[model samples]
Target: MKIAVDAMGGDFAPQAIVEGVIMAASSLPADTQLVLVGRQDIIKELFQKHGFESSAVEIVHADDVIEMSEHPTKALSQKPNSSIGVGFKLLKEKAVDIFCSAGNTGAMHVGALFSIRAIEGIIRPAIAGFVPQVNGKHAIMLDIGANADCKPDVLSQFGEIGSLFARHTLHIDHPRVALMNIGEEEQKGSVIAQAAYQLLKENKRIQFVGNIEGKDLFTDKADVIVTDGFTGNILFKLGESLYGILKERGIEDEFIARTNYESIGGSPIIGVNGNVMIAHGISSPLAIKNMISWARQQVEANAYIHIAQALA
Candidate 1:
C-alpha cells in the first residue's frame, strides 16, 4: 500500500518529518511504499543522511510551504505547489491510499474537502480524537474541531460514527455512547444537544447512555462521547493544557505520561473519502512514525468501509 507524507508541514519541517518516514519504512514490510511530498532537494539530502534506500522512498517536489499562521483558505487557493496541496492531490488521484500530515489542521481539513471530498452518506466529516480513560479504556470524541455549530442530525451522526470507532478501533463490544452536556439529564444542555440526546437515546443502532459531563471523561463512564465541534474542541484544548500543567507541577507523572499528545500519536479524520491522519504540529519522530503505522493499520482494516456500514 502507498502512504503519502507531508514532509514540510510540521514545526520541525523536513528533518523530523523525513526521519519519521525513514523509521516507518525501515520497520514496515519491504513492499510498503512511502511517498514523501515536499521540496525535492532537502528530502534527497535527508534520505542520504538517514541511509534509506532510494527505491523504497520517493520524493515528490512541492515548491511552496504552508505556514501555520497563514489563512487556510487563501493559502490553499494560492499555494498549489504547497506540500498540503500536493499530498491531497495524490490522495484524490488514487496515487496514494493514505495521506498523513502534521500541518495546520484547518488547512488540511479544507484542502481535503476540496480535493478528495467526503464519503457518500456523511455530511461534513468529523475529527475523531482519542481520550484515554482509567482502567486502560479509551473513549472517542467526535467533531473535536471540525464544525463548531452542529444541528441535531449532525450531532446524531457524531454519536453513530464515534460509537463505530469505539467498537472497531478500540474493540469495545456494544460501546456506550454519551452526549457531552452540562448535566446527565436529558433536558440539560443547549437545545441542539438536548435534541441530539433524545435522538441518540431512541436510536436502535447505538447503545446510548444518556448525557456525560466533562468530569466523567476520564473515568471510563462511556466508551464514545459525542459533542459539537465547539464544545469538543474546547475540551480537547483544555485537556491538553491540563496535561501540560500537571507535567509542569511534576505531579501525576505516570498519569500525565499516558495522556500526552506524543503518546497518542495522531487523530484520524473520520467520514472522509480517503484515510487521513493528522498528528500534533509539535510531534517528534517517534510520534510521526506511530502515526504512519496507525494510518496503515486503518487502511488495512478498511476503517472507512466499516464506519459507513455501521452508520448505515
Candidate 2:
C-alpha cells in the first residue's frame, strides 16, 4: 500500500515532515511505500542531509503550496499543483491508498467533499477525535469541528458512523453510542438533542446508550460520543488546554499524557470515499510518524469497506 503525505502542509514544512517520513519509513512494513508530495529538490536535499536512502520512500513534485490562511475552496481551485492538491489527486486516481496532511483543515475538508465525495448513504461526512479514558483506553467523538449545525437525522447518523469507526478502527466490538447532552435524561439538552435521542434509540445498527453529560466524557459510560461539531470542537479544545496546563505544571500521569495531541497523531476524516488523515498544523516529527502509521493500519483494516457495508 502507498500512503501519500503533503510535505509542504504544516507550520514546520519539508524539514519536520521529511524527518517524520524517515522515521516512519524505517518502521513501516516492507510492502508499504511512503510518497512525499512537495518540491522534489528540497525533499531530495533533506533526504540526503538525513542520510535516508530508503527504496520504500518516493518523492512526488508539487511546486505550489496552500497556505493555512487562504480560503479552502479558493486555494484548492487556484493551486492545482499544490502539495495538498496533488495529494488529493493521487487519492482520487487510486495512486495511493491514503492521503494525509497537517495543512489547512478547511482545505482538507473541502477537498474530501469535492474530490471523493461522501459515501452513498451518508448525509454528511464527520471528523472524529479521540477522547482519552481514565482506564487508559480512548473513546471516539464525532463531528469535531465539522457540520457544526446538524439536524436530528444527521446527529443520529453520526452515531452509526462513530460506531462503525470504533469497531473497525479502534477494534471495539458492540461500541456504546451516546448523545452528548446537558443531562443523562431523554428530555435533556436542546430540542435538537431530544430529537436526536429518539432517532438514535430507534436505530438498530448501533448500541444506543442514552444521553452522556459533559462530566461523563472521559468515563467508560460511552465508547462513542455523538454531538454537533460546535460543541464537540469546544470540548476537544478544552481537553487540549487541560493537557497543556498539566504539562506546564510538570505533572506526569499516564492517562493525562494520552491527552497530548502528539501522542494521538491525528484524526481521520471518515465517511469520505478514501482514507484521509489530518494531523495538527503544529505536529512534530513524532506526531507525523504516528499519523502515517495509523493511516497504514486504517488501510489494512479496510476501514472504508466496513463503513460502506455498515451504512448499506
Candidate 3:
C-alpha cells in the first residue's frame, strides 16, 4: 500500500511534517511506502539533518502550497501544483492508496469532491469523525464540520453511510445508529430531526437505535451518531478541548487522554471515491505519526468501495 502525505499543509510546514514522517518510517511494513509531497530540496535537507535513510519513504516534488487562509476553490484551481493538489493527483491516478493533509481543511474537502468525485446516489457527502468512547472503543460520527445545515434526507443518509463506515472500519457487524438531538424521544428535536428519525427507522441498511443526547457521546450509546455538521463540529471540538484543559490541571485520565487529537491523528472524509484524512492544522510530530497509523488502517479497510457497492 502507498500513503501520500502533504508535507507543506500544516502550520509547522516542512520541519514538523518531515520529522513526523521520519518517526513513522522506522515501523513501516515492507509492503507499504510513505510518499511525501513538497519541495524535494527542503525535504531531503531535513532527512539529512536526522541522518535518516530508508526505502520506505520517498519524496515527490510539488512546486506550490495552498495557504490556510486562501479560498479553497480558488487556491485549488490556481495552484494545481500545490502539495494538496499534487497529493490528490497521485490519488486520482491510483499512484497512492490514500492522501492525507493537515494544512487546509476546506481545500482537502473540495479537492476530494472535485477530483475523485462523490459516490453515485449520494445525497451529500459527509465528513466522519472518530468519537472515542469511555468503554475503551470508538464510535463514528458523521457530518463533523462538513455540511453545516442538512435537510432531512441528507441527515438520513449520514446514518446509512456512517453505519457502513462503522461496520467496515470498526469491524462491527451490526452497528447501532442513533440520531443526535436535544432529547432521547422521537419528537424531541427540530422539525428536521423528527423527520430524520422516521427516515432512519425505515432504512433497512442500518440498525436504528432511537436518539442520543450530548451526555451519551462517550457512553457508547450507539456505534454511529448522526448529526449535522454544525452540531457535530461543536461536539467534536468540545471533546478535543478536554486534553489541554486537563493537562493544565495535571489531571491524568486514560479515557480523557484518548480524547487528544494526537491519539487518532486524522479524520477520514467519508462518501468520497478514495481515502482522504484531514488532520489538525496545529498537528505535531506525534499527531502526524498517529495520523499515518490511522491512514494505514483506512487504506486496509477500503471502505469507500463497499459504500459504493451498497449504494448501487
Q: Candidate 1, TM-score vs. the true structure?
A: 0.92
Q: Candidate 1, residue 93: CA error in Å?
A: 2.1
* lDDT tens per residue, model 1, 167-260: 7776788999989999978899898988998889888889999988989988888888888899998888777676778878877765566677
User: lDDT of each prediction vs. the true structure?
Assistant: 0.84, 0.90, 0.94
Q: What is the lDDT of candidate 1?
A: 0.84
- Greater lDDT among 1 and 3 belongs to 3
lDDT, candidate 2, 120-161, per-residue tens: 999989889988999988898998997889999999999998
Which residue pairs does candidate 1 place in steric collision? none
lDDT head-to-head 2 vs 3, winner: 3
Error of 3 at 215 (Å): 0.2
lDDT of 1 at 240: 67
Lowest lDDT 10-residue stretch of candidate 3: 161-170
